[model samples]
Target: MTEAIASEAASNPGMQMKYKIVFLGDQSVGKTSIILRFTSDSFDVKYQATIGIDFLTKTVYVDDKMVRLQLWDTAGQERFRSLIPSYINDSQVGVVCYDITSRQSFENVKSWVEQARQ
Candidate 1:
C-alpha cells in the first residue's frame, strides 16, 4: 500500500521512503493548483475539474533523507463524495483547501476534515 521510490546516491544509497498526501476540498478550491505548484513549480490559469481522482509523485530531500511524496487530488463534486473514503483510508496526511474568496468553500473545510478523519 505504501508507494515508495528508492534513491541511489553516494551519500545515502538505497534509501527508500514514501508518504501519501491527500487533498480534499470543494470544487474549484485550487487543490490541483497547489499540487502542481509544489511538484512542477508551474500553474495553469485554465480550470479543469478533477474527474474522480488524480495522483502525482515527487521526490525530495528532507534533512538528508530521500523521500517520495505521493499526492492525491480528489474531485470536489457531490457525486464523487463516495469515492473519498477509500482514498482517505490509507492516506498518511490529508490537506483541506478552500478558496479564500469564497466563504462557502471555507465553511466546508470542517466537513471535509471530518470525512478525511473517518
Candidate 2:
C-alpha cells in the first residue's frame, strides 16, 4: 500500500519530475531512520518496526531542476518479504541499509541487492 505525504513544489520554474526511491534492509537496520534523517533532518532513538510500507515525499533541487522524490520505507521482516518485489519493480532508486555494528546485517547486503534486482 502507498502512503501519501504532503509534498512541496520545487523552486525551479520548469516542469517537475517525480522519482520513486525505496529503502530495503533487514529488521532493525535503520531504514526508516535514514529516510527520516534525509527528509526531516530528525532522528528518533526509539525503535519501531515498520508495517507493510510507509511513504514520504520531499522536493529537492538537482542541477537546478526541481525533483520530487517519493520515498518508500519497507518492512524488513521475513513475513513481509513477499510484498517487496512489487515495490522494487516500481522504484527508480533502491537504497539498501545495514547496521554498521552488525556483521550479519553487512553479510545480508548481497541478499538484499538480489531482491531489489529481482
Candidate 3:
C-alpha cells in the first residue's frame, strides 16, 4: 500500500517518496498519544483504546524533497495482536511504546520489539 500510494503520486516521483511507520506496545502505553501529538500537535485526556488499526498520514519536506509518512496506529489489545504482523511486514519503521510508570508495560517492550523484528 505504501509503494502503491507513493507510485500513484507520479507528479514528482523522484522528488517525493512515502514510508510506513507502525506503532506497537501494550494497552494504555501511549502509542496513540504519541501519534496524536506528532500529527495534530494536541493531546486528549479522554483515554480510548484503539480498535483494530487506525491510520494517519503527514507530509513534510526533507532534504529538499517531499516525504509522506504513513503512520499506522495499531490497537494494543490482545485480540488485535494477531493483525499486527502484516502491517509490520509492510512498514519501513516500527515504534515500540511503553508507559514509564508501569513495569509491565516496560517489560512488554521486549516482546513488542521482537514482533517488530520478526
Candidate 4:
C-alpha cells in the first residue's frame, strides 16, 4: 500500500500526515480482506461480516514523509449502508471491492461508486 499511495502522499517530511481510506462494497466481497492484507500482511479465509465500521491505522514512509493511513473497513450489509456517507464525507480514498464470482456484487459497484462520488 505504501508504493500504491506514495504518489498521492507527495509531501515534505515535516510532520506525520493522515489519510482516511474508506472501503466500500457489498457483503462478503473481501473489503476487510484487502485492509488486513495491507496492514498485517495476512489474509483470512473465513467470512466475517464487518459490523458498523472497523478503524485501523498503519504508518509508512511515503515520499520521505511519515504517512498515516486510517483504513476504514465499512459494513457492507444493506442495513449499514445508511451510515456510509457520513464516513465517506471526508475520505481521501474510497476503495470499492467486489467479488469476481458474484454478478450482483459487481453490479452494485456502480451504486457504491456513485455514493462515494457524492
Candidate 5:
C-alpha cells in the first residue's frame, strides 16, 4: 500500500498536497471501488448502489507531515443530486471518473463537474 502511495505521488506530486477529497462521477464508474481500494485494500465485484453519500478519512504521511484526506463518495444517481451540494462544501479536491465502455457515462461527467462547482 505504501508502494502504491509512492507510485501515485511519483506520477502526480500534486496529490501529496493536503486536500479534502470528494469523488464525483457517473453511476457504476468505479468511484466507490477506487475509494475502497485506497481505504480498505479490498474490492467486491457485486454492484451495490450508494444511497446518498458515503464518507471516509485516511491520513497519508507526506514528508514527515501528516496529510489527511476526508473522502466523500457521493451517489451518482440523479435522485441523489439534492444530497450532493452538502458534501461539496469545504472539499478541496474532487475526482470525477467514468467507465471506458460507457459513452453516456463519460459524456455526463461534465454535468457532474458542473454540479460540484455549484
Candidate 6:
C-alpha cells in the first residue's frame, strides 16, 4: 500500500506540499525516539531498531495558515545510508540527532549531517 501511494505521489505533479521535514542520525542515536516525542509527546524505552525508514505526518498552524509536515525518519546505520538519498531529496528542513551523553554518538553526528546534506 505504501509503495502504491508513493508511486501515485511520484506521478502526480499537482501534489505540492507546504512543508516537509527529515531526521537523520546513526544507529542507536535515538532518531525514532525523538520523532515519537515530537509527534506524540511520548517515548518508548524498548530498543527495537527502525529497520529502514518511517514517516509521520502532522498538521500545524503557521501564522494563521494551516500547513502539514511530511516527516521522514531514516534508518541510522552504515548500511542504511544508501536508502537516505530519496527520503531527504524533497525535504525542506533537516534534523540531525545524537545521544547527549554518548561521545561516539556525538562524534557520529558530523557524518550524519554530511550524509543528510547530500
Best by TM-score: 4
- Candidate 6 versus truth, CA RMSD in Å, comes to 7.9
Instruction: Write down the TM-score of every candidate.
Output: 0.87, 0.86, 0.87, 0.89, 0.82, 0.79
Worst 10 residues of 6 by lDDT: 1-10
Ranking by lDDT: 1, 4, 3, 2, 5, 6
Off by over 4 Å in 3: 1-13
lDDT of 4: 0.89
Q: What is the RMSD, in Å, between candidate 3 and the native fold over all Cα?
A: 4.9
* TM-score computed on alpha carbons, candidate 1: 0.87
lDDT (0 to 1) per candidate:
0.89, 0.86, 0.87, 0.89, 0.82, 0.75
Is 2 or 5 the stronger prediction by lDDT? 2
For candidate 2, the 10 contiguous residues with the lowest summed lDDT are 1-10
How would you encode candidate 6's per-residue C-alpha lDDT over 19-73 as one tens digit per residue?
5688887788888887788888889999878888898887654333445677788
lDDT tens digits, residue span 1-118, model 1: 3223322333456667678899999999999999999999999999999999999999987556678889999999999999999999998789999999999999999999999988
Q: Which stretches of candidate 4 lie over 4 Å from their true place?
A: 1-12
Clashes of 6: 1
- Candidate 5's C-alpha runs over 4 A off are 1-18
Candidate 1 vs 6: which has more lDDT = 1
Tell me the RMSD of model 2 versus the true structure. 6.3
Model 4: which residue pairs collide?
Answer: none
lDDT of 2 by residue, 12-115 (tens): 35667688999999999999999999999999999999999999999877656667899999999999999999989978789999999999999999999999
For candidate 5, the TM-score is 0.82
- Lowest summed lDDT over 10 consecutive residues: which window, candidate 5? 1-10
